[model samples]
Target: MAIAWYIMYRKKRFDRSHDTEKVCPRADNHPIRINGSDSSTVLSDSNQSRDSPRTSEWSNMPQWLEGLRRKRVASACGIPKYSYKELQKATWNFTTNIGEGAFGPVYKAQITTGQTVAVKVLATDSKQGALEFLTEVLLLGRLHHRNLVNLMGYCAERGLHMLVYVYMSNGSLASHLYNEKHEPLTWNLRVQIALDVARGLEYLHYGAVPPVVHRDIKSSNILLDHFMKARVADFGISRQEKSALHSSSDIKGTFGYVDPEYISTSIFTKKSDVYSFGVLLFELMSGNNAQKNLMEYVEFVALGVEDNEGWEEIADPRLEGKFDVQQLNFMGGLAYNCVNPVSRKRPSMREIVLALSEIRKPRNSETYRVITEETTFELDLQGTFDSSLTER
Candidate 1:
């Protein structure tokens, strides 16, 4: 029986690889014997040795055997087994839909153990499937940081794939910035959020073993918790670093956030992530969506640098002169560096984190006053505009 099992396993592997017996002579080799007994006899003895009814007794054994084997292997690796019904119950029948993206809809759920989690259920016809689910679980599960979302567990049963992550109560950074109902985030908070996001990206690019590139880094993908702490989420396009300096792939990322260099060359690198990060920083500083006014802002800033006019005039008016000019200028410099048309000119993630961190530290009294005055002037300008213009 053991010999039969060995033969079957070898044949399965060979067939899966499309390798024929004529090309591989070793495929005909018989299973080796153990002690004095034949290998086939040992497998027979072991099959019957179990007290429970033998799996072979079932008529549908062959059809179900592979799935059973896969489940056993998954279990050995500490992956949890969850039924669709269990997930449905935890999600209140999928009633609480909090968010949705390229993968699918995310629901706020409470596990039977009473822990709140965000359940990402893959769409029935999602273009991304088990490969993405496995990547996120394996990558995000092992990563632990205040700035990166935590993966609790996952379910892959009956072709229904889902990822379970810690609940982020405040939704996404994009929502907070663009949603009018939510209170405006202070400029300081926005700076801090940028710093947090930079740190997370730095960790993914340099801190992890083999490192990871978060191919998708945008406001909508950055979630905020109850305290408004930013945590990087969504890993559908993430890829592990290889020994080679260049990675090749077809263009894959959100339109406004995709790296121009990568798009042009079809080669991705850490700088690709930096480019996306720059776009996110621009969004935070300008309070504008990348898809909306970023291109115009980029053109304006380019013209400002060429024409020698200070670029500070383009700062977000909604801030009402409440932000520091030096800080804003520093952030703009970083954003400019990040969005550099030449990918090699972009600052590394480490440099980005360090630069943002420096800005967050308290400045000297003179610098503080300068920032305050600039902020006041902005507020005054906005007030003047509001008074002069009719309501739209």
Candidate 2:
């Protein structure tokens, strides 16, 4: 397969990215390190969260949690802790079931304070349940960004592990893409979604204190708020920069979106997340499923990295020719670089954010021309530039 970049293991000298976090490639893969960095104050902007519900008597228990009522466990991250009985009632007996994840069921609810939240109730039988629960609670509580979902609170009692999250009214990006009942996403909106998701990943890879890698980043995992703004959710499978444990313990991710090299080597890095993001670009562009490897199905189409006609075949016909040729070419071109078989060839999430932001500007402007330099095609894994990129 043609690959542009090869994975390079080296430290970057940027200011925000320090040795303390110790992240690289898919660096967010380990448990929270017990260091001074873990206690860095939560971003002040994230403090807008409304007051939590008042504590109440414990109920719906096996008589065990009752003894530990006054002695509740404190989240190491200092996030709000909710009682199991409180969450159960907030979710109205878990009746407003919204969705499901790797560990359990998610329900829509109104907490005692009248604030809306989505509660994910961990399944009793999932072996990975505890790990995923802790991962999200610890990671999200400390990491905050406009593109990342906000974790309102959490509940751990009576053999139950549940998390409370701010509700997104619009729902997952997948619902609008694959489901017919929802309205089609316009080109600008699609570009915005891509940009938003990229920003979230950029924050995880660069902005977070200990850069994180969202192991699973697909359309289904991306939620759009009422304003159509995207938020990267589901940190259950996420890892911190220092944790390389996934390479030996588990191979996680949606099948079609998994990085090819990662599958071969069983090593996931931040670039692995980039590989998945590439598939996300394809989904936004073509309105197709990546689960069946649609990227491969249209590989020839992307090979024409500069051929407008070849890319037209790749874009979602749903736009009805309303999309800009330059934007499509630039985005499709970027996506091509992202899924490069070699992880190093994939553009970093930071690079992706800048590229997408550039796409939002006027096509006739100097910035548009500047994007050309950034979009220049890199050679494949064999170190040879593929000429088929121009072939229709």
Each model's number of backbone clashes?
A: 7, 14
lDDT of 1 by residue, 1-392 (tens): 99999999999987754432222112113111113121111121211222322221123323232332355333212335466788899998999898788899999999989989999999988876665666675456455566889787777677677888889999999998899998888999998899888877766665554456888899999999989989999987687554213555657788889888888887778888988998998888777899886857766765654222344665777788888776776677667767778876566676566556667777652221111111211112111111112111
Candidate 1's C-alpha runs over 4 A off are: 1-69, 73-81, 243-249, 305-309, 364-392
Query: 92-148 in candidate 2: lDDT tens per residue?
Result: 788898887666888999988898889988888865556677677667767767788
* lDDT for predicted candidate 1 compared with the true structure: 0.66
In order, the Cα lDDT scores of the candidates are: 0.66, 0.69
Error of 2 at 380 (Å): 16
Model 2, position 201: C-alpha lDDT score: 82
